[model samples]
Target: AAQTDAWDGVRALRADYRTATGERREVVLGDGTVLSLNTGSAVNVRFDASRRLVELLAGEILVISGHGAGSGVPLEVATREGRVRALGTRFAVRQQDEYSTVDVFESAVEIRPRDGSGAPLLLAAGRGAAFCRHASGAPHAVGAYADAWSRGQLIVDDVTLGDFLAELARYRPGVIDCAPAVARLRLSGVFPLADTQRILNMLPNSLPVQVRSRTRYWVSVEPAS
Candidate 1:
């Protein structure tokens, strides 16, 4: 079953904020930083004299550095893999099971892996990087629509059905099985994420696939009969 509750216990006990499945929220920190929490996301905020830390316990978050009345303290977003220290920039950080990805939209950020073996890297604006506990990948160009989800939209460009569903699944509960038969079908659009079921129903209008639901919690996309 698909679920984002792995960090539920930690979130209940320590998280400063979180968003449920299919829900998006924005939070303002003490230092004037704005945090946009994506679906199924949880975070814990720790502000001290030395630094400001927003520990991502699960899912994704978009951070906009604030220039508020608070004192100047470095703001960082930490995942299980490593820490992303903001350089007076705007960025989004996503936490996955094996690695974490950072998309920098403005200014730059310093990525420091949890393990000491790999050297830290300075990623500039308009670039993205994926890093694990021990090493970081080379920065690559990223699309401007990286933060589209914050606006309750999913903008895909000629992506495979399987890939698209994999991302859509992040916003809902239960399994969204894309049968291999129809997985290769491509799609592109600006779909409203407010209603995922409506999005699923609209797929057949563009692709050669049919959506079947055994229950609200189980859905499969297969080749249209």
Candidate 2:
């Protein structure tokens, strides 16, 4: 956690995350693959005229298949939760706190929990899952988080405000405190990065809590009356 290099290998690099401002960077693996990293995210490359590998830290990222690599050429991601294997597809891997999510946009990926276990969990398109860091375990869904990054949209059914806020905070950096009184409230809407401020402004209209900004770098939810 002290001063150190956040990146490794020439194909991958880590953007600066020191200024409390989310940072993003791009990398082109030796195989002509393009990668777009998100805020507070970092990656390591594993390519040397043989295989292709990438590792992700926090935030979101988009991976496009690169050519000049053989069919079934391994495109793997290492994270705090475990290892993810891509299968001729586009995918995004996120590691936030104790939670790690893999959303496959195309094809499938095999997840081998960093538990050092030999077997792995297979994830197909349109389905996503979460892993618990302590136990090297994860849940299965039919790719629910599939389009979280590529599509830039979310489809939530009936869920508590607390759950929704917890999910929304993944995209934004820093703190987003929600009051207990309004955490149970339920609502649904679409929020894009371009309209994040609008989303912040709209929250107070429905709940009794006000969304106050602290220097625009942090936010807190508090009782309105």
Every model's TM-score: 0.93, 0.74
Please identify model 2 stretches exceeding 4 Å from their true place: 1-28, 69-72, 132-139, 142-146, 151-155
lDDT of 2 by residue, 1-225 (tens): 122223321223333321112344566666767777765566666666556777664556777777755434787877767878888777778776566787777889888877655567888877677765433345456445445434555546567778877766765766788878878888766666434557778877776778889866587777786
Q: Write the per-residue lDDT of candidate 1 for residues 1-225, one digit (tens) a residue.
A: 125445444563467888889999999988789999999888999888787899998889999998775448888899988899999999999988778999999999999999947557999999999998888998999876789999999999988999999999988899899999888889889989899999999999998889999998999999999
- Candidate 1: pairs in clash: none
Number of the top candidate by TM-score? Answer: 1
**Per-residue lDDT value at 209 in model 1:** 88
lDDT of 1: 0.89
How accurate locally, in lDDT, is each candidate?
0.89, 0.66
Residue 167, model 1: lDDT of: 94
Per-model clash counts, in order, read 0, 5
How much is the lDDT of residue 127 in candidate 2? 69
